[model samples]
Target: MIKYHVRKDQAITEVKVSGHANYAKHGEDIVCAAVSTATILTYNALERMGFKDNLNVSVSDGFFHLEVLKPNEFLGYLLDNLEDTLHQLELQYPKYIKYQKEG
Candidate 1:
């Protein structure tokens, strides 16, 4: 199963994603692929928008952690998109994924 946590506070949003869905073999798991695609898209967008100075990130096999140190309205909106995507996935595949959001 894959588990992720999102934290939102004033001027900050931290997201951590870890583990594989294991819905199928590692290379052929659609659940994992879907999550990866969504996460990568968010990460890329943050980078392209020049949030590098206000962010901390770590990416590796089956893990991604993004910390938004100085979130603004735009960044918050973008991160909300990410949360929505993950929430949809969690709802669709309750057996394979879990999501938690906190403040």
Candidate 2:
């Protein structure tokens, strides 16, 4: 299963995604693919918007972590989009994906 954890602190947000959905074979897992794409795109988008200095991102097999050191409205919007997407996926694949929020 994939476990997604989100944390909020003042004007910062941190997201940690780990594990595999295992809904299908490696290359055939749509859930995993979607999550991976969303994370990568979010990180890239933030960097492109001049948030590179305020962001920290790490990606590895079955793991991804992103920290927004100084989040703004746009950053929050992006994170909200990501959370919503993951929640939607979780609804469809309850046994393979889960989400949690913390402060």
State each candidate's clash count.
Answer: 0, 0
Candidate 1 lDDT over 1-103, as tens digits, reads 8899988676338889999999999789999999999999988898899877888999999999999877778888888888889889999999999985544
Clashing pairs in 2: none
The parts of candidate 1 lying over 4 Å away from their true place are 10-12, 100-103
Predicted structure with the largest TM-score when compared to the true one? 1
Provide the overall lDDT of each model, using Cα atoms, as 2-decimal numbers: 0.87, 0.86
TM values, all candidates: 0.91, 0.90
lDDT of 1: 0.87
| Per-residue lDDT value at 20 in model 2 | 97
Return the clash pairs for model 1, or none: none
